[model samples]
Target: MSIWWSLHLRREAASVPLARRLLLGTMETAGVDPDISYDLSVALSEACANAVEHGGDTPDGTPQAYRVTAYLDGEKCHIEVTDSGPGFTAPHRAPRPASSDAEGGRGLCLISELADHVQIGNKPGRGGAVVSFDKILKWRKDAPLMAV
Candidate 1:
């Protein structure tokens, strides 16, 4: 089975869980393996949290909304979170924060560890940060998500 969705949400703390719930519901309904679903959802939460906290750094004031997109094609799932904040200078090499006790700065590190493939950069033309990731889906034998 193939499924896809896109969400444009306000850059607010409340919107983070909304995005996560949608992802979780879609993955569960699609019969993706529980472990995989959980991992991706956690990673997605980190990405969404980053977007919410940093999405409004545009010169003309912070962007009011961010975009989250997810696609499931057979045994693979891809997700992207885009924000209107100033793009990251270096997402290709996200090292753990120097201060372990720091309350933040670990989003990208967590995402990189969970996702099989990840791409981070500025959105085409729009000049925003885009964090995209893909993982091979592991499905439950009886979920009927695909031929599996």
Candidate 2:
């Protein structure tokens, strides 16, 4: 069986917690192994943060929203983070942590290393790009995830 979860939230920092909660719930309900759940949570958080930061316009206290989608098959999980402002070129390589003792740009690197597959592309009929990743559930003996 395949399971899906989705959420749309305004482009505010406060919405991050909601996203995290939703992500955690989805992973838990989908039976993701506990050992890898932390990494998935972190990676998904990073992806959503990027979408909220770079992919959307200024907060302005207006009403713009970002979308996150997660789907799980028997042995794999896939996720997509999207914003409403605009789409840009995919990062050839994930941004590296800065040497100035700054904490930034490490999210993509972590996501890339943790997920079995990562893809960035324009969302169909949308104004922004979708940053997506997938992880294979190693603890299960189910068949492979088919691209249906």
The residue ranges of model 1 lying beyond 4 angstroms of the native Cα positions read 57-63
Q: Please report, in order, the local distance difference test score of every candidate based on alpha carbons.
A: 0.86, 0.73
Q: How accurate is candidate 2 locally (lDDT)?
A: 0.73
Q: Write the per-residue lDDT of candidate 1 for residues 1-148, one digit (tens) a residue.
A: 6899999999889998999999999988888999999889999999999899888644667556999999998879999999987677654565465477888888888898999998888877766789999999988887867644
Best of the candidates, TM-score: 1
Residue 65 displacement in candidate 2 (angstroms): 0.4
TM-scores, all models, native as reference: 0.90, 0.77
Candidate 2 Cα deviation (angstroms), residue 41: 0.9
Kindly give the number of clashing pairs for every candidate: 1, 0
* Distance from true location, Cα of 1 in model 2, Å: 2.2
Task: Please name the candidate that would achieve the greatest lDDT relative to the true structure.
Answer: 1
